[model samples]
Target: GGTIHIGYFDQHSENLLDAMNESQRVIDYIKDVAEYVETADGTQISASQMLEKFLFPGNQQYAPVYKLSGGEKRRLFLLKVLMSAPNVLILDEPTNDLDVQTLAVLEEYLEEFNGCVIVVSHDRYFLDRTVDRIFAFEGVGNLRQYPGNYSLYIDYKEVEAATKKAVAVAEKSKETSVKPKKSERVSWDKNKQRKLSSKEKREYENLEKKITQLEAEKAKTENELYNAPPGEVSEVQKLHEKVESLEKEIDTATERWLELAEINS
Candidate 1:
């Protein structure tokens, strides 16, 4: 097997703190990992410069580790891990206690990281921003792999559920059609009389596909909004409006689908 170096960041910082000297300044703690680390673009950066990049300014870098806030400690731990320059990074609930600015910086860092990242997080926006594939746990000992981001995975599951429900409805209809009572037969005749027209039937068949497409588009737009650079206020607003519009479209199509399904049944 090939050799792999793993850098891990846990949500609970106590374990990491116990291994560190509390009196050490943040810069010293980071320098202990490395005096300088190379960036993705081949330039080497000093510990202080790297700390600044991670949102620790010059003043904050001189403070003792014990004086840092909970969120700051977590951010420091994350920076330490990154400074180690491991090939594989494992983050367990890395978002806990982290401020939004830190989270955004981490997201940007991950975008340029030249390594594999395995994250266990419940933050949907984080997952959407950082990951391209998902491993979803369905039940005990049942983990399934999906070949897309979190949003796309959710879309697939929803479509699968709808298809299953349609199949169940068709089976029930078949079972009821066999040897129905007189009143039941009359009800069946009424249902048949209200069957969907050719165009309606086509629309019904395509609604699921259409909804899936719309959902995917909405997911993409939301991701764009998340990654949009600062000061692009107008662009952000437009993306938000697009997401709401797609939501409305999905709702309208779903209602129409339900109507056609009822008529056909």
Candidate 2:
């Protein structure tokens, strides 16, 4: 029932091209929306000034829309939508076809925007930088709300998975109720006293090297995740998974190394 203005940006910019004349100059296209618009800081700027903020220079502003590059056209369309001054912005896959420079500027603009931004994107880095809350869609028409960003949501899921695994192991142990006999326990202790086998010695040396390599790889992957730029959704996700895999490998190798060390001692 409340009055709210909505601005929608479609990933497929071709559909919106009908509203924009290819023969029209970029500055005229924006001026058609508004000659002057107020920024979030309560400062009024003209159409050309606003264009410059969006990375359009004086010469480029006078060029026809048809002469602009594909990325530039996409940026112009986005600026047009924002210049209309809507209270709510709905961007669908906005990162598609946008260059890194434009994406960085857009992130900054969203940070200062007073309106509500509803972004539907697969870009993990974008979501982590922009939104504080997440609405995850599970299968079978179930939608869940998380109170944090994309990274936080991933942490929650990992914790949930570990908890479930632990509970299942506990339940299985209770059901089995198995214990070794006294002779079996003595045999195990004797086995621990024996020196490492030839094959195990080789494996033990390899495990130490493997663990060290895995640790280095994990550190590099973590640094990549920390410094990754925007619009790298698939790369970021892959780096996260690689880090997890390396951690598991390090743990397993360390356990084997300790086993061999105790036997050699």
Let me know the TM-score candidate 2 reaches against the reference structure: 0.67
lDDT of each: 0.79, 0.79
Expressed as tens digits, the lDDT of each residue in 1-265 for candidate 1 is: 3679899988886577677788999999999899998878888899999999989999999999999877778889889999999889998987885789998999998988878889899998898888866788998999876545676557656655654575476557545635558977887677668878899889998997998898799789867855665435456557656766776787677767765776687
Model 1 spans > 4 angstroms off = 178-265
User: Model 2 clash tally?
Assistant: 0
Clash-forming residue pairs, model 1: none
lDDT for each residue of candidate 2 in 188-247, tens digit (9 for 90 to 100): 567566888899989988887887787688778767765565446566667667766766
